[model samples]
Target chain A: MKKFLNDPVNFVDEMLEGIYAAHPMVTYVNDDLRCLVTAKPKAGKVGLTTGGGSGHLPTFLGFVGDGMLDGAAVGGVFQSPSAEQMYQVTKAVDQGVGVLYIYGNYSGDIINFDMAAELADLDGIAVKQVVGNDDVASSIVGEEHKRRGVAGIFFIYKAAGAAAAEGLSLDEVARIADKARMKTRTMGVALSSCVVPEIGHATFSIGEDEMEIGMGIHGEPGISRKKLGAADAVVDEMMERIFNETDYKSGDDVAVLINGLGGTPLEELYILFRRVRQLLDARGVNLKHVWIGEFATSMEMAGASISILHLDEELDRLMAAPANTPFFKHVTG
Target chain B: MKKFLNDPVNFVDEMLEGIYAAHPMVTYVNDDLRCLVTAKPKAGKVGLTTGGGSGHLPTFLGFVGDGMLDGAAVGGVFQSPSAEQMYQVTKAVDQGVGVLYIYGNYSGDIINFDMAAELADLDGIAVKQVVGNDDVASSIVGEEHKRRGVAGIFFIYKAAGAAAAEGLSLDEVARIADKARMKTRTMGVALSSCVVPEIGHATFSIGEDEMEIGMGIHGEPGISRKKLGAADAVVDEMMERIFNETDYKSGDDVAVLINGLGGTPLEELYILFRRVRQLLDARGVNLKHVWIGEFATSMEMAGASISILHLDEELDRLMAAPANTPFFKHVTG
Candidate 1:
């Protein structure tokens, strides 16, 4: 478990310092809070805030920019940002229009961010909360609504970012983010586990020749552990489950994301997306857009996840909107 | 040397197939050639083209989007795209506004891409070429103009893509891309060598306690190899050389990119970037913008690089422009 750090405890602090040093256009609320605010806040646009555990480079923080998130509350590695931290970020990033609290659905994250949102409201800040529950692997067959949030949170970011970039109000931003979340579903698998730098050990274990099906981003055990299989088969199982959980139909336009869970190769993700595309094509699903790479990561775990979103005209337009942050940008069109 | 592939020979083909399946909006020129074109190519906009080996995922392919590149010509893993392949891509992507050829500088890449540009011009398709030579490690101190191109090519894509997206003519886009090359410089080090899937072995050699400085992205050995040192010390040596070789001044505004070669963790890139910022700040250098991640990968090697660019007003505007590709997007005001 070799790493490039002097002390494990200094990891987050040093990382944030470097991020700030590299990007002088962003402001840090405080060391204790671990909140980042835009250097130049938009006067009337709804402020967007998101945060979670660290290690998923570019997920919450990477998406911060003009159109994405105005602020991000960062926690420890694979740990939730504190309630106080989220509150500070909300206040710092908020404009007269208000702020949107978008985040994943982990128990710790939900409790903390929920508390932050309440606190913001008491402080005379209009803050709306939206929890992304798009992970099909975290729910039972009949409990799709209970799914946890995973990489699918990226779509929420895109939607919220686009809306806010368009100068939407807090209500409009929340609505678009929630709508994007409803249309999105994701599932991940881990072929190998990762070592947390702070802990200096593997978070979980997997046999060299075996893989865990529907693994969570933090290396949490999935519904089943199975032998590593062919790319097509893996994609089929993952996409089929996601497809079954979502109300996708033939001729329905959608955007697909094949994400590397930190350590997986782009080669593998592309392969997974290929199989996913084939399956969708067989079902007569119309694929309108696709993204493949490490959008959301979990340390250095060799795994990948698939996210499918049935798109509407609004979502599609938002998808094409411009965004610029340290780790992401969507300005092509 | 573990990899996920059925056969070595099928690596590139399968990867291409998988990309096509994932994004229906992207279609390749030929079933055999890895020249990916946008599903909807805009008319009257100067077409942008970039291509390189497969290992640098998102570099050549991940960048094909509306404001970015129109098409990408992919070669084998760490191999150069053939002249004919580039020629085919130019023809397929050209919208009657001419084509801009932007690629990295390596012997094979230069030869092949140059040949392609010549062919395109001979066919009466206005073609412009700009070779990226930004790797400060490969150049002599007194002759900085002879530097090689490494991971800094990603910036080239963004700047050029933004210009083309704004409907810049081929000549103007070429000039901007060339200016970006002049402003950029990169230097990389390897803690571990990368293994090409097809070779089933590493492309270079490194001991458990050794490191290579000034290595090429193809796993080629660096100019020197020595015992590994602390992150700060290692970065200091790299940055001093890079800074000394360029026109960057203490108060000059610059863009910093700390790119992981492939297998290194984001945690490490942070540590390295921390030291890098400190060194730059101590010298009175101002970092206007920064990006740290696996933007340009080289298989799954455990290494990283530092890229610095002196941003002029035009370069800054171009750098701040929006880009929409699979891996990167930047929408700006």
Candidate 2:
């Protein structure tokens, strides 16, 4: 593939520089650290931060704004940002209000962010952390809490940001973030693998006519391998697993997210949503809201995920709260 | 190429349904009209709105949030949303603070948006419209005012939204938006054409060894065709034109945007930015900010665009103001 770069190693740094240049309202620490902080840190409002490997545009960084994250640390393509980098972002965005750190459930991310939280506490900056493990496909039937977090991270960010905006304490933010995670569940499938710039090749190879179910965002091994199927069938498989994993009964209100894994077109996402609508309706579940697009992505991988957040009246109110960020936004009803 | 839709024509409606399903805080009029309005219409602040076609996910809708756009009229893929749709969004979001109609310079968008403005006036709602004609590519010498707007529309949205969020009046917001457009310029190149869902094929064709300059977002013809060159050379060519078009003086402040046309990666964008930085530094221009991503895309077309906005103190202040949206957010410094 034709590409632009002098050295593969410099790709992430250069992109960060470009981002910092275009958005003066956004600041960064160690260029090598890949830690980005918002220009405005709301004093007295709990700070929320997230970081992960790069490549998913607008997920971590894009969520930093008036009612979203306070800072973000971006790692190299598909690699978790370093612990030190997360620590710096945590420090930068800290404004007397304690900080809440949320990120995906990847092993590296968990270790690094956990380390960063500890480091923040040492700085006299109170910090709490929440890991988003919402992927139903990555968990055993009985170990649902260990699932990998996918695009459903947006829900956590929204709920946490709104809580912070409402002057919730750090512990309160973390508590609500955990609640959001509990309400969220995700499942993804991949039809193709992405070519990492530094790696210079596909992370995993798949036959043209094959698809992998429960594929983790960072190209982690999925639960099942099968031939490519229609969009509805794919949606059914993902929704079934996600529904089975999450506890929801008829008449329950839920938020549905049909997220593209970077390469899938809106056309296909819609096709998948059609089936999702049918199945949810049939189950007597009230689909209160929906979002479809490339939210969290795995570079140029072609696939989709279905995420459902079973909502209570409180969760519904929080979800309806106005949110603004680079990659997602909403105004309450 | 593998795709997700059973039928091509169902792209927009299906996508809209998915959006509503996922985001409970947003609503649509005509439900099938593709115009998205925030559920909370009266935020006690002036409402900002934008409209465009589908290919640019997050551009129109992504900008809707706190300190950004209040609503968006999304059209068919790469097609202008109708005037009636724009009118509907305006009516929905007008909280008596008046409404600002911001859009690109396409003839269709202009005509339709104007119709919407007139329709709003008939309903006793104050409305002001500003067109983003920021592309330095499509105009002749001394005719930059006629340039077609490209990705620079985002800058206009940010600046104008900031002003409105600060309680600027309708006319004041319009002026700032116009000022932003005056300082912005964009130029795009296409490495490959995007396959339209309805067509199931590329709207245009280029050879494996070739690319085109000054291409429109919707696979329209470009100003020039040439063999694909190195990433630096390609950026240098784009910069040379954009630099000369802006007449940016030494030590002048400007915001630079290196945007992917949808399919390019960060590796390539950064590679191009590496050269962009060198060229600007050599010219003594102070780079105030940079946004590198698929902020404005044309489906999965593999190409990139460069946008430069000469910043004055006022424009800079507005640019630095906080903004929150789905695809982008600006925090005050």
Candidate 3:
């Protein structure tokens, strides 16, 4: 495999060491290297925590900072963090208020986080959980809750983190997070598969001239694979799936994110955003905010995803709230 | 070519359209589709304008926002923007104070920007220029002016933009920009070449097991091409060259940037940064700030560059100044 790595066996440890060395605002919680906590945690506020596999950056760790996640449990590439790691992070970040865990709706994450919550309960530290299920391509129309979580976790993190920063109770923060997840929809198109470091090869094979619509972040089988078409046409298919899954209406205010799956450049993300804007305008969907970059990604995967969040007044305000992290920073106007 | 594009001929125009559509804080100049200007220009402040080939994002266009560049003139992929385009952006951003032009030290860019400065001078708008020559591998010792600029343009933008935002005069801002450029040093390695959309093929070729050290952003020949080594060994070679070129002292404070050339994953970047931090620590060079991401990219090239800026007190404050752009946001403490 052509990768900038020393050894596949040490990839996770080296990456975590690098992350800790690079970011001064965050540090390991106690002796548990798997859990990273913000250095300056706000008092009398609900502690927000998230965890998942390592490949999707700016998801769990990148979101750990002021006005966002208070801590994160990082696992190996595409592998979920253990329940013990999550439990330690929960105990470390709880500032007498409580802690809320927000993560993607993957079976591994759900199982681990639930176990962590139960463990935390024994210590009298209240812990709430919200599993993001915004990937519309993962399930049928009436089974939105069964869908896999994707880039829409960004919206959930922003909304729930804002609520927590406002000193909301753990339950209230969880409610807002759940609301954000329900309103957000995402669909992805993969031009190529990503190689896991340990695997040393692509998780799946795709032809040069072919593309998979509705592919999961972990290379799960998508709705269909077809001849790769123009940028606008591929975006159109993704958008149609999202619209059909969500209750998007004319004149509704929304936030849009055109996310790159690692290998894609910002130039292509903007190209894809242009088509997204054109289609949304025709449908009378007002874009209140638009983010175009790699918020979450599969390691070196060449593709993109579109995520739309139907914003209410509260959601709009929360989305606009200030956040300062390694990967994301939003200053309040 | 496997790319997410529509018509190769219209790639630049379409990308600009997408940028203007996605960012509400920036708008195209009147009658100049290639020029992007901030919607709300701070009056009396020296206008900061930057431009170059279109492929390196967050370098030019992504730096145009509040507390950053007042305007950007975008060009075709790996092709410099015309003199007329730069002239138009200069005219749009100048607010009677003056304008400072900061761009990479490339033949086409220097020629075009110089022409535009002359044109602006005819219209009574004072224009000062600072050509970035931070790529240490591009030239020999005492010939820094002949070196090409790479990821170090990011430091130039932050320092000069901060100076201008502080209401410094044109000459002062230009002086600060020049100082930033002089203090910055960068070295890059490339595992693969980037493809220009119109070219429909890689700009250069290398063997699967080979890597090019000190390669330019636009596929210029590097110092050497050899068998790819481990990540730490590669980083050590790059850092040794940087230390040899610059007089980095034991107690000197420096800002570090590990920039991905579009296709490298964040995991690898941090892994690289881990070694960079170790080398600097052993040398006793204090790292005051660190940034790791795709700052200046070559479309979708799979590699990375290291930039080190030896910072004094003034440079430190300016680097920490508040700036809010799509790709970069530094919140003042």
Candidate 4:
């Protein structure tokens, strides 16, 4: 594995230490550095909390800033954080209003976050949850809750965070979060596998000339592994799955997010974005907002994921609203 | 190659087209999609234009937007753009206040940009150029003018772009760019080589357990090729070269930019940044600002470069000013 690390055991902790040293906008809430909360947390606003595995940068922790998550319980690479850690974050970030949890729809995350919600309820902290199930390739239609949440969780964050920032009640924020979760869909194609630091080797392997369509971030099996072909062909397959799986129809508006899975270059993401826009245009789906970069990523995995958020006026406005984070920032509302 | 491209020959143009379809803020000039200019160009302000080879995504063209470059003449991957292209960009963005040129220092770039400067001169437009030579590993201490430019050119961009946005004259903006260019220093390491899409093979090679310290973006030789070491060790070697080769004294305030060449993970970049901050703290250097990401890259090369900009009050303020680009965006000064 060509990774820069000290002790494999300290990979997650050291990465957290690095984040603490790099930005003044974030700080740990307790002795457990894994329990991170935003330093600029807004008072009297409903708290936004998100957490999951660690390899996906700017996803779980990096989004903790203005107009986003107020607290994030960081996990080890591809491993869920503990219920105790999540409870710590919820208690720390909650300021009488309540805390809303938004995280990916993975069994490990669901169990931990649900347990954390129970623990928080015992502490008089009102907790509501909105789980993301955006990766359509992970499950069949009508079984959307079984799908894995990928980069499309970012849309849920935007909707819910903006709602909380607007001083909405926990139910209102959860409503918007669920709306975003329902509207967004994602599909990924991995050209190469990523290594877990502790493992110090690739968790999975594939032929040098092959790519796996709809690969999970943790090297889980994708729908198909085939010889890599033209960019347009790959995007067409992805768009077909997303369109067939989601409720999007003609004349609908969308915010397209082309996420680079770690090792993919920005040039390639734009190349992928080009086809996505064309595909959307041909389908009479209006591309209203475009974000083309690495919002969510695996660790040094060569791939790109296409995430489309079907946008209504409220979601479009909230997502377009100014957001500031170490990784994602938009100045204009 | 597992690169997501249709025709390797159309790599640059397709990436440009993708950019055009994605963001309405940038549009090309004169049917040559290579000549990109900001759609939100500020009239009466000194126009900042930068250009060079493509593949380094945010490096050359992606910087063209509000508070950054007004125009950029793009080139094929790892190749300098033509003098005609630069001249076209200069002429189009010359808003009566004259234009300032800032780009990397290389024989190909200097030759082309200088020729373009002459062409602009004949057109009665004042053109001032700041060629960045900030790579500390490229030359001896006193012979800094012979060094190669890398990611440190971004400091020059932030300074000069802010100065121009402040309505400074071309000369004043160029002066600030020069100051930033002089104070900044960078050093890099390559874990693997990158492929130019059209070339269809790796431009250079290294062993699995090897890393080349101070390697140039286009596979230029570095100071050492030793066994791949820990992140701290790699950073120590890089920091030694930067400090030993520059005039940084104790108690200096500087901004740090740990830029992934292309393929390195954000986690590794942060791990490297942790050591960087520790070293700077030990040396009594105050780390005023921190930027850690892929600001410049070598298409999927596995490596990273560390750039430090020593700041005076004016440069500190200008560098900290809000600048918006498709790649680089800062909402706060």
Candidate 5:
């Protein structure tokens, strides 16, 4: 494999060490390398935390800073962090207020975070969670709760973090987070697969002229493989799936995120966004905000995902609130 | 070539249209799609403008915002913009305090920007220019002026933009920008070649087991092609060359930027940064700041570059000054 790495087994630890060295705002919790917390925690506010595998950057770690996440429990690439690591990060960021765990809806993450919350409860710390379930391709209708989370988790983090920063209680914060998750939807298409460092090979492969529609972040089997089509056609297919899955309609306010799957360049992401905007305008969807970049990604996977969040008044206010993080920063109302 | 694009000929215009649509802070100058300017300009300050080819996302267009470049003239993918585009951007951004043109040192860009300056002069708008030459592999020691510009252009942009935001005169801003350029040095290694959309093929090719050190952004030949080595060894060779070509001393304070060439993962970039920090620490160099991401990039090239800038007090202050752009946002100092 052509990669800049020392040893495959030590990639995660060394990467975390490098991140700690590069960002002053990020620090280890209780000397545990897997648990990264903000250097300065805001007191009397609900502590927001998230964690997942290492490949998707600007997801858990990059969101740890003022107005976003308080702590993050990072795992090895494509693996889950231990319950012990999550407990420690919870303890590190919790002030007088409680801690809430937010992460993608994966079996390993759900199990570990539930164990950590149980452990934290014994230590006299209140804990709650809202698992993200935004991927429409993972399940059929009436099975949205069983769907996997994808790039739409970013919207949940922003809205829930804004609510927490407003000094909401842990229960209220969890409610807002769940509401956001219920409204968000995402779908992705991949032209290539990503290689995990330890594996030293691509997780999967596809024909050069074919593309996988509705693929999950971890190379999960998608709807089908088909001959590669034009950008607009692919976008139209993805958008139709999303619209059918969600209750969004004309004259509704929404937020849009065009996320790149690591290997795609910004030029292509923007090109994809152009078609997305054109479709939304024709449908009379009022776009409140648009974000186009690599917000979450599989390591060096060539693909893109579209996420749309139907915003209510409360969700709109929370989404528009100020946020300052290493990867995301906005000073909108 | 596997890419998400429509007609390759219309890629640049579509990408720019998407960027304009995504960023509310940006708008076209006089309905000209080639010239992108900030919606809100700070008057009586030196108007900072930078432009280049379309592939580098955050370089020329993403930096047009508060406390950064006032405007950007965009070109086709991997192609220099025209003099007419630069002249229009110059006219649009020029307040009473004149305009400063900052871009990479390339033959087409130099000729076009020079022509734009002449055109602006006839229109009674003062224009001064500073070209960046920081790539250590493009030229020998005495021919530093002939070196190609690379990721180190970001440092020049930050320093010069901060100086211009401080209301410095045209000459003062140019001087600071030039000083920053002189103190900066960069070297890169490419694992794979980028594909130009119009050509629908790789710009160049290399053996799977080989890497080109000190390669130009557009696939210009590098210093050597050798079997790919460990991250530490590659970094050591790059650092040794940079140290030998410059006058950086043991007690120097510097800012380091580890920039990805579009396709490398952040995990690998951090792995590379870990080795870079170790080398600088052993040399007694104090790192004041570290930036690790895709600051400047070829379309989807698989590689990375390291840039180091030895800073004096003025340059340090300028580098730390607050700036808010679409891709970069820091509230330091």
Candidate 6:
């Protein structure tokens, strides 16, 4: 595997160190650097805490800041962090309005966050949660809850962060987050597998002329594997899959995020976005806002994902709110 | 080569089309979409225009916007735009205050831009220019002008963009850009080669376990090709080379950009950033500001570059000035 690292085992912590060193406003909530919390905490506002594995920059930890998530419990590359770490973050950011756990729908994260919620309950801190299951490729219609979360977590974070910043109650904030998760859909394709440092090899392999459509970020199986197609055909398939799984139709307004899975050039992303825009217009969908970049990544994997958020009144308003995260410095609605 | 594209020849144009569709604030200055200019131009403010090859996004076209650049002339992948296209941009952006052409240093770009400047002179638009040559490994200190411009152009862009925004004259804006370029130094390492779409193969290649230190953005040979080392050691050598090429002393303040080449993970960029931070701090170099991300790329090549901009007071203020570009949304000094 080709990559850069010191010790494979220290990959996660070193990355966190680099992040902590670069962002002056970021600090660990406790002795563990993985338990990251913003130095600026709004006491009266509903605090949001997310926990997930590393490898996805700006997904969980990168979103921890003003107008976004307040704290995050980070794990190793595609590995789960401990429940104690999540509880530490929950405790640190719980500024009396209670804490809301908004994270991916993964068993590791769910168990750890639920345990953290129990620990918070013992401390008389109310906790609510919204699990993101927006990857349409992972499950069929009416089985969205069984689907995995992907880059679409960005929408949920932005919407829920804005709701919490408005001083919403914990339940209201969680409701908003849950609603955002329900409205978002993502589909990805993998051209190359990302090399995890500790593993020192690709998590999986594909033929030179092959690609896996609807592949999960962590190399999970996809709905289809075939000869790599053109950018237009690939984007068409992705958007078609997303539309089939949703109630998106003519005259619907939506926001779009074209996420690069680490290795794709930004140029290709815009190319993908161009076709998506054309497809949406052809189908009478009104594309309102667009964010094109590496919002979520899979550690140098050569691929990309398209996330469509069917925006409603609340999501439209909240998406427009300003967020000052280290990663999405200009990701306003 | 594994990539997403319809036809190799249509790559650059399709990418530009995607950019045009995604950013409504952006438009072609002429019939040719390669000559792009911002819709919002500040009358009486010195206009800044740049042009270069296609693969390096944000390096040229992505930097065109308010507080960054007024216009940009794009070209085919790793190929220079025509002089006429650059002249189109220069004329469109020059709202009677003159135009400053800031771009990377390369034979093709230099020759074309010089031709464009001569044409602008004929039009009496008062054209000035600043050529970026900050890649320390491309040339020695005594012959710095022979170096290649890499990620360090971001500093020049930020500084000159701010200067132009402040209503500086063309000459004054060029001065600031030149000063920024002079104070900046950069070094890069490539773990893998980038594939040009039309070429349909790698521009160059290295061993699976070997890396070339100081590789140019377009796969120019570096000073050394050896087995890949740990992140810390590679970063240390890069920093050591940069320090050797400049007179960066203790107590001096600086800004940093840890740029990821196309295929390197953001995590690795941070790992590199962490070492740079420690190296500077230990040398009594006052690290005041930092911008870390894929500021520049080499078309999915696995590598990164570190740019160090020694900041003076004016440079510091200008770097902090607000820039609303499609890329670098939060990159204030």
Per-prediction DockQ: 0.42, 0.26, 0.79, 0.85, 0.77, 0.76
| Residue B47 displacement (Å), model 4 | 1.1
Writing each residue's lDDT as its tens digit, candidate 2 over B124-214 gives 9898888888776688778765777789998998888889888888888899998998888888998888888787777888887688899
lDDT over C-alpha atoms for residue A187 of model 1 = 85
Which pairs clash in model 6?
A: A319-A333, A320-A333, B319-B333
Tens digits of per-residue lDDT for model 6 on A89-145? 999998998998888989999999999999999999999988999888899888778
Quality class of the docking in candidate 4, CAPRI style: high
lDDT of 5 by residue, B55-158 (tens): 88777788988777899999888789999999999999999778989999999999999999999999999999989999999999999889999999999889
Q: Which is the winner by DockQ between candidate 1 and candidate 6?
A: 6
TM accuracy, model 2: 0.77
Residues B266-329, model 1: lDDT tens digits: 7679889999888878888777667788878887777899988888887788787656555665
**Which should have the higher TM-score, number 1 or number 4?**
4
Q: What TM-score does model 6 score on chain A?
A: 0.98
Chain B vs. true chain B: TM-score per candidate: 0.95, 0.95, 0.98, 0.98, 0.98, 0.98
- Binned by DockQ into CAPRI classes (incorrect, acceptable, medium, high), candidate 1 is acceptable
Better of 1 and 5 by TM-score: 5
Instruction: Please give the lDDT score at residue A59 for candidate 4.
Output: 82
Candidate 4: segments with Cα more than 4 A from true spot: none
Which lDDT value does model 2 have at A42?
81
Better candidate number, 1 or 3, judged by TM-score = 3
Angstrom error of the Cα, residue A177, model 4: value is 0.4
Worst 10 residues of 1 chain A by lDDT: A324-333
CA deviation > 4 Å runs, candidate 6 = A331-333, B331-333
Cα lDDT for residue A250, candidate 3? 96
lDDT of 4 by residue, B1-333 (tens): 889999888888889889999888889888899999998878899989899999898898888877778999999998999999999999999998899999998899899999999999999999999999988888888998899999999898888888888899988999999999989999999998898998889988899999998889889999889999989988998998888866667888898899999999999999999999999999889898889999889999999999999999998888778988888898782
lDDT, residue A39, model 3: 87
Tens-place lDDT digits, model 2, residues A1-333: 445554667777776766665455578766543778877778888888999988876676878876889899888887888889899998888888788898988889989998898999899999888888888778787786677878899889888888899887888889899999888888888888876767877889898779999988889899999887766677877887777656678999998788877766555676688889889889899988677777887777788888888888877777777765544556543
Off by over 4 Å in 5: none
What lDDT would candidate 4 get against the real structure?
Answer: 0.90
Compose the digit string of candidate 3's lDDT tens values, residues A20-136.
998878998768777899988888989999999999887769988877899999999999999999999999899988898899989999999999999999999998888888888
